[model samples]
Target: MKNKYNLLLSLMVFLFSACSTKDEVNIPSDVTNLRAEARAGSIMLRWDNPSDLNFLYVPVQFKNPLTGAIIKTNVSYLTDSLLIDDILAKDGEYTFEIYTVGEGGERGGNTLQVSCTALPRTPVVTEHAEKIDFQVSALSANASDPTEGNLANLIDGDLKTHYHTNWHEKIPFPQWIQFDLKEPVEGVKFVSWNRNGSNNANAEEVYITGSNDGENWVEIGRILPDELPTTGGAKFESKMFYKQDMTFTKIRYNAKSGVGGKAWFSIAELEWYKTWVVVVDPERN
Candidate 1:
């Protein structure tokens, strides 16, 4: 009888220990140094993650500024930053609430809260007040067709002629045409015409870069393949609107490849214009 009683006591103690362990829960610690930074049409949130091993994820809650919808997102514990994009510019501010979640679905007691106003959106150009022609001081190119079409033909104002890259021999692509403006021109956009009779030789990938001293250049604009003119004898006027004007004296046009996978390309004419516009601030209105 004594042995049986001892065995029953041992079994009861094991059962009690298992029940206590299964019911245990761990609550996560709160994030630290949480902050929000405002950007144009977007808001950036960053924080330092908690060192607690039980931390599994974070929940970010906000109301859409453009639409009256509740936004809730789950972020991995390993991530410490988030970018909320496509937010509309408004007179009111946005509020954000963030908290941590633990492995056992326990919520952290502390929640971080912040309010921020995003930067103003880029204003649309209601009208082009003026387009002043800018003079090119010099012209250069990496490769030209040996048989016909000289570099001088690019600015000669003749639609019948063109400037063609080497066709007799294969020239590795990224063929370029560069020009220097007599002086720095601000708020500039360019117009380029394709070869008069054919579009097959037009560049598919185009990038326009600008430099003040002609040594170091920064990308000012890019022309997508669909944006390039598909029909022959057509013109492509850059539609990229700059929020802040860029002033430069030198401009380079790089052709990564020609249409239909050809190595050579052609341009009929190139022109630059100084644009003028007036934007009324929404707050002032």
Candidate 2:
């Protein structure tokens, strides 16, 4: 009877220890250093590793503030960062939560709460009309003759052909090509393609000026060879948005020199963006 009592006591002790171990293994410690950064169209989440080794996975939850919809993701313990993209939330505040899943599927307390806002989308624009019939002038050049080099070539939209100034006939510095947009534009952006030749002759400095009339021009944008590579491909330049969109009927491009001292200012193609406003007629409707 004494031996049997000792054996029974040993079995009870082992059972109690097993249960205690299981309980301890199923509880997870909290995660630390959770952070979220708002980007152009997404949010980046980062965090430090959990102190406890009992966690099996980390589950992140995103909530839509307007629709009350939920998005859930499960990540392994090894993942310390994640980027959530294409979130169709409007320009407003949103929240997210993180929780740690223990070995036995038990979830620990909430680790962190994060809030961020989506940025406003940029406006869409399309190609506008190019002024092909405009006056061309420089300090001196052969721009008058259509057969040789003319201002119309700038807006011809043909990359194979370009407008080249007569460098041998006159000095190439401080050349300009001006045109009438015919109609006023709400806003404008410019793109220029350099002449693609053996030497890759391109503009070293270009200035964009706008005016309501043919005279009294105002500088709206500037492009340098450093900012816009004057070789290989076309260079795109954008104008800064003003307090209110301005209207301009005349646009001019003034060139100072050629990239790498190529002796002339040559442009293959020039394009511009114009904001168009649509008018609805109530009588026709």
Candidate 3:
């Protein structure tokens, strides 16, 4: 009986140890940048496809970004990407769970939970910050689709998808693209780039402007070389500041500025930004 008791105790200890042992779970460390763009009353959620992941069944959750309460019914797709209508989200904290769905729907995600709330989407600048949640810049390869050339979302590095719905015959030189910010913008960042280490007919120039509506525009900044160099296309960002509380909504840049009268550019990207840090002046005696 003594021997049996000892054996039972040992078995219990072994089982507890096994249970306590940290089992390696599939939790992606790479922050999957997610963004929701509100278009025609719908919120499109786009995030990076997890690496080293074969197939993912993500249980995408979203709520009032204000309150921590769980929003219902948004528990939708296990798809590679998710696009849900705004009507589904309550409006506080928008959370997502990527289910590492393997063969037979074997789940392995959300074991280590991660979340970000979706408030009113209001960007208010404080003393330290220009605006709350003012996405300074993002560095994610998956932000834009390589093949389709589409972009989406503001922060969390979701690419705002845009391209010539169809290919052009001439492949228009000095390609130009623009973006429309929903709210009032006071800062514009001209993000433009071209191919690396290959200057053939690659001539690229860039310009910037702002506006109240999406139509009327005005030049706010410009960048050009003193003289056109033999091998140097525009490759940098110019942080432009806007004053007078002017509401801006459009972004336009030279896509493929012709070089030596013959060369079109395959623009890698053009990122735009908006910062509203309003100051209220007080009179002093």
Candidate 4:
């Protein structure tokens, strides 16, 4: 009978010990630094790190507040290593929150809020561009390489374009590359950014030249940014075309200069500026 009692007591002790295991996730700091940047027609989400946690040991999930769309991914050491690009947002209010994934987890992560004017202004083709068989070839350089590229290298120039060759290289200037529109208008009126150089003085250069027949360029204007490269090499997508109707063919954008001070300039797309709000008929609302 004493043996039986001891065995029962031992079982109770074992069960209690099993239920009291130390939590594997030690959330020292959480408050995901979520940031939202609006560019072109897309909005980018930059979130803080849940990274230091175990890789395969624990999985993370991202949920969309509107659609409830959930994405499962692993959290490593890289911060904001994930991007949400499903953009169906209109001009309104939106909010998103992040919750930590536990081992069958509990809520302890980060949350952030941002407001955006998710609208874009596209230009009305005054004259439909007659497609020309033109291809642009770009050549570039840094403090390390200095031979800049051309329209063919930056963008396919055969389409009806608005700018031509624009090249601007200077001291204390960001390294850049550009696509010159063959047509001429005003100047670079819009300023949006994606992946810029590595510093606050955004190391990107944009200059202008004027031409009529897509050849014979002349320097006219430029836009030098004041930003830097991402500390992490994240893919940046930004656009800063034009807003008011101007005239110029030869527009140039240079990025990632040999110039130092945390700068790099990368562009995925560039377009001509057109007014975002257009009234077809003033009398009709």
User: Runs in model 1 with CA error above 4 Å?
Assistant: 1-137, 241-246
Scanning candidate 2 in windows of ten residues, the lowest lDDT window is 136-145
The sequence of per-residue lDDT tens digits that candidate 3 reaches over residues 1-285 is: 999999999999998888776453333333255555554334566666556555435555545555566653422234445555433223433455443444445564433234543323333334322322323231222112244334323232322322221133345443554554556666665444443344444433555666666568777766564332334334555555564646666555543355555434334334555554554422110
Structure candidate 2, residue pairs in collision: none
TM-scores of the candidates in the order shown = 0.52, 0.51, 0.35, 0.33
lDDT (tens digit, per residue) of candidate 2 on 1-285:
999999999999999999998877656766778888887567888888765555778888887766778889998887877787755336367687887888778877766888887554333443443323333331123233235476666666677777776655655466676656656766566667767663366678877777776668787777766776645556555554221557787766777777777566677767666644444432122
- In the order shown, what is each candidate's alpha-carbon RMSD? 14.4, 8.5, 22.8, 18.7
Q: Which candidate, 1 or 4, would have the higher lDDT against the true structure?
A: 1
lDDT of 3: 0.46
Q: Give the range of the ten consecutive residues with the poorest summed lDDT in model 3.
A: 136-145
Q: Where is model 4 more than 4 Å wrong at Cα?
A: 19-31, 54-83, 86-91, 102-115, 119-285
Task: Compose the digit string of candidate 4's lDDT tens values, residues 1-285.
Answer: 999999999999988777665545444445366666765434565666545552222234445545676656555334453444434344243454444544444445454455543334333333222221223442223322233223333243222221212234333443434444444444443333332232233344455344444455555545454433333222332333342454555444444342244333333224344222334421121
* Winning model by lDDT: 1
TM-score for candidate 3, residues paired by index: 0.35
Whole-model lDDT for model 2 versus the true structure? 0.66
Error of 3 at 142 (Å): 24
Scored against the true structure, residue 199 in model 3 reaches a CA lDDT of 48
Give me the runs in candidate 2 sitting further than 4 Å from their true place. 1-25, 33-41, 84-95, 109-178, 186-208, 221-244, 252-285
Tens-place lDDT per residue, model 1, 145-253, is 8876487788888988888999999999889888877767555577889888787889998888888887888877778888899677798888643425577777778
Q: Backbone clash tally for model 2? A: 0
